[model samples]
Target: MTAVTDEGPGQVRGQVAGQGPGPERGRNPDEGSAPREGLPKDRGRPGRDWDDGLIARRAVSGAAPQEAPAAVPDDDVRPQVEAYVPSGSPLSPRLDALRELVGLSRARLDRTDLAEAGRVLDEAAARQRLSSRHTVVAIAGASGSGKSTLFNTLAGAQISEAGLRRPTTAAPIACSWTDGAAGLLDRLAIPGRLRRRPQQSGTGGDEALQGLVLVDLPDHDSAAAGHREQVDRVLALVDAVVWVVDPEKYADAALHERYLRPLAGHAEVTFVVLNQIDRLPGEAADQVLDDLRRLLDEDGMALGEHGEPGATVLSLSALTGDGVGELRELLGRFVQERTAATRRLSADVDAAAARLRPVYVAEGWPGLGERAREEFADRLAEAVGAAAAGQAAERAWRRNAGRACGTPWLRLWRWYESTRQPRGLDRTVFAAPPEEQLTARQRVEQAVRTVADDAADGLPGPWAQAVREAAVRGAQGLPEALDKLAARAGAEPGRDTDTDSDNGEPAEAAETAEPGGRTGAHRGRAAGRPPRPAWWPAAVLAQVAMTLLQIFGGLWLIGQIIGVLEPGLLTPALVMLAGIIGGPLVEWSCAAAARGPARRYGQEAERRLREAAAGCGRARVLDPVAAELVRYREVRERYVAVTEFSTTRG
Candidate 1:
């Protein structure tokens, strides 16, 4: 067993598994355990928390503590994300979760903030591939904390200089107990000259530490910025860490705030060592250790008490070798268990999740509503003038009905008037007020805006903007489409006649009968020929018969005045009266018969225009908005997958 010198690191020279000072030579250790630096002398002793911790690993690979170590020679540098994370491993979901997260951000989000996540995953994979047998633990501390001396004591050799300024050697020093750690040291960027072997040859009575690669990091509070940078870099790359703090600088704010606090989640892979505790006077070492625990708690770093689950805390003196055996035995189990890589990676994920959690949308998602869709359709119909078209249709029906059923004299009068002037239903039917037509374009724009807002509501900024853009794209030709829908004459779309047919488009302008249209289009219903009433022919016959009677009676009167034979004045006068009055009665009856049918046809025409307008809107604005909403929900699910891992992990 080996003990340490208080005044100089050189006192332990040439003692690399050779003749080092015994427990009797130095002041008694804080733990009063073995004389050796790492090997415990009080084996099988009661209240030995250090020995109890070495029971066995939690069986991560289903291998016992005595199971053979993995061979550490391979050529894998950069494996695919999935290839590294086997099917049933704890890290399997993390690959997809993080990959999906990054993919979504690049494709849809405004800024992908977690670039470190990639490095974390890559390092995890790279570590897994390198050496399963080895565990690389770094000894980190502020300048003048004697972490280098602690590093040397652990290796059983003066491999690192005690008081060397970090500016002279900005890079970390590495010592591997096993032979296959060259690649691992290379990955840490430790130059070949800085690499050391704990023994001159063989295991050298340190078989329990066979797979340990201990690193002496550059001082954390080094005035040379490069030294601090090196410290940060190596800490990120290492499997586990032992933070060395003397009693004076144990509660240093820079150390806690910059490193420990941020890395609190990694308590499992952490070792908080109260180094140089022999310098504490009286029972003050215990008090200092307790105060350090309090500071760690404030930093959100949990401490393991009575073998509970938390960070491994210990007080040791690299000089007097006090509690040094306890620290080494605990580390022996930590390295042999071989779970540092997994724990470090899991903590990295926890950290990544914390960084991204603030911006995550936790509320239930808002969807595209059916009510919004109907409102959008209604807007489009109004913009296209379906209401006004219905009125025009009714008027057109009346004009056509009058031609079929009116008295011959009245029909002749209407024909004469048509030659002079025609208003509302004059041949080309749809004649909405100019004011209503003027607002059609504005109404269409409003409809698009409203639907876009509804669809984009409650969405993230980039996704919301995407939905709006899709809506705008769909609305590009909508106004023209609506106009074409409503601007039809008295016919259905894409047909030659106002009636149903297989013929081509109308040849003449009047034949086309432009009616249902928006804004610039004729804003009214198509007034194609309306169906004739059943009694039209009968009404024509009766009117013609009355006219003949009037003619006969008038002739009879004229003959009587001319002194022709047998002329009765009462008969002629009654006949003439009957004919004139009957003509008026028949005309009135025909006008009443045409009214109901005319109104029905008008309504049907308007409905067709409205439906067309609605369909156009759905194709243009609503469908695209709906798709965007779907895409966003998909992105949201991906985000959940990414964050779910953090919550579920310890």
Candidate 2:
């Protein structure tokens, strides 16, 4: 019996009838005394058993080792092999996450990075569609690390230059295993001159690596700036990276600090190779590999998930081909999994999100308080001259009330005094003082600015600026609006009658007799009633009777003096005194009674005017300011939503 050998990675040797193990290689546990139907009398010393060496080789190569077949004879055994199974694409979900971020933040944030991320997604998607089966693995290393030699050895030909040129592999070289990778190569910007084809003999086990495209990149630490740039550019776009480091420079700080440290999260598709181990003894190679792993751990990289050191730490000599088969096997498995692209994209997203975490952090979202709102409103009222207007209305009402109900004898003097208009009005209603003349307009404008500034306090720069702008916009036409609103409010209440019309006629008194206004109008109108009291006629009749009595007394006294009647001087004089005193007392009493009505009318007028002015202030100033506050709140909510994702992700 002969042991089957694999020439290239994952290639299986041909099986002979009844002379070897099953089609799949590996020693069967029950093979010691099994009889076969074939006529070979004696199986030559049992074919080399698939032992620890083979299993260890596959394990170190990042491949899942298959179970050994049963030792049952060929008549009863039939091997089943699955050729290819594709891992579902992970790029779709990652792209969706990226797009979600862009959708929410583009309007509010600096989108330069987001735009670049979008480009990456688009390019990645297009590349995957054109060549889903292809796995782009780039060979990256610092200068003099045997990266090109490994690339050549992997290609099974002299594809990349491997000699003593300082900063070799100036341009990237792509080695494709199968046809149809031309479009993908173009997308990667690999020139036709740098492209090569690896030799392919048969399908079988080699079919697993059919779509693998290996790239030889320029030195990462190359003195030539362009060479380093080339390495960086290819590293960002490739599906996987195999970092080739020799035993001598395995722990170089330039490689770990600049590249590995930053790419810690990308360990899934990262490979750290300890190349040129032929220079070191077996034990020394092991020690070097250990030290290299320690350095990788310090850089915060987790290996093994995607064929990197965490899974299998490789120490091979690209010059002598020693231990090269293990690496090929790992590459074969990596290509078969077909997950490198998705893994690469996912890591990129993670890195992008990490960079964006700071901008999305939270302080707190407590909104404007009720106290602030009321304070602002009060300021606005003062600015609109609401208080002054109210006071003027009160004074004007009192003047009108005094003229209407004051003593009839003094009416002329009172009317003359009242005809002079109050300080700021021609009518009994309230209006805003002229905007330009009134200090209130400027005060109101300042109050608007103050309120806006207050609302924006403690907010982020962009959001705070937004709130301020909204407030400024709301206040743009406010001064003029206040004036118009005040005029309208003042006119709306007393439209029915021109009670305060400028005139000195008795008709003015008649007009004042109509119902007064405001909260106190009921009492005012009742008090201002000018109709004669029920007993007023009686008082007048009594006064007339007293006068007649005085006249009779006087006549009697005169007759007596002339010697026509008996003496009555005392009675005649007393009657005259009573008539005079009673008339004056009644007049004084009526005047006293009218005072209450006049005062009530004044109060009612003042109340109405104040209400009108306040209404105007609310409409023209407070309401618009409130609308701006509402807008700020809405934007705040949107901002919070946009930043919330970052918070949760971080």
In lDDT terms, how accurate is model 1? 0.65
Superposed Cα deviation of residue 487, candidate 1 (Å): 4.1
Residues 24-92, candidate 1: write the lDDT tens digits: 121223311111233122221223223332212111222212212223222223321222233565565
Give me candidate 2's TM-score against the actual structure: 0.59
What are the per-residue Cα lDDT tens digits for candidate 2 across 1-650? Answer: 00012121111122233433212122211221221122111111134222222111111223332223222211111222221113343345445556666665566556653544465556555655666667889898866677888887787667687655665578999887765667667766888778876644223236657879889988766656566556666666677889887644455545554567767767777888888776664376676677677778777887574533343457898877888889999889888877667666666656555555443433565345667666676666555444444433443444554444333434655556666746433323332235433465567677777776777666555555656676677677765665555555544434422233434322232222211111122112212222233555555565456556656766767887998987777876676667556545555554565456534544444444445444544555456555555654554454344333331111
Top candidate, metric TM-score: 1
Which candidate leads the pack in lDDT? 1
Candidate 1, number of clashes: 12
TM-score of each: 0.71, 0.59
Candidate 1's TM-score reads: 0.71
Worst 10 residues of 1 by lDDT: 1-10
Over the full model, what C-alpha lDDT does candidate 2 score relative to the true structure? Answer: 0.56
Q: What stretches of model 2 exceed 4 Å from their correct place? A: 1-114, 199-208, 247-258, 277-329, 354-362, 366-379, 386-413, 418-442, 450-460, 496-650
* Least accurate 10 contiguous residues by lDDT in model 2: 1-10
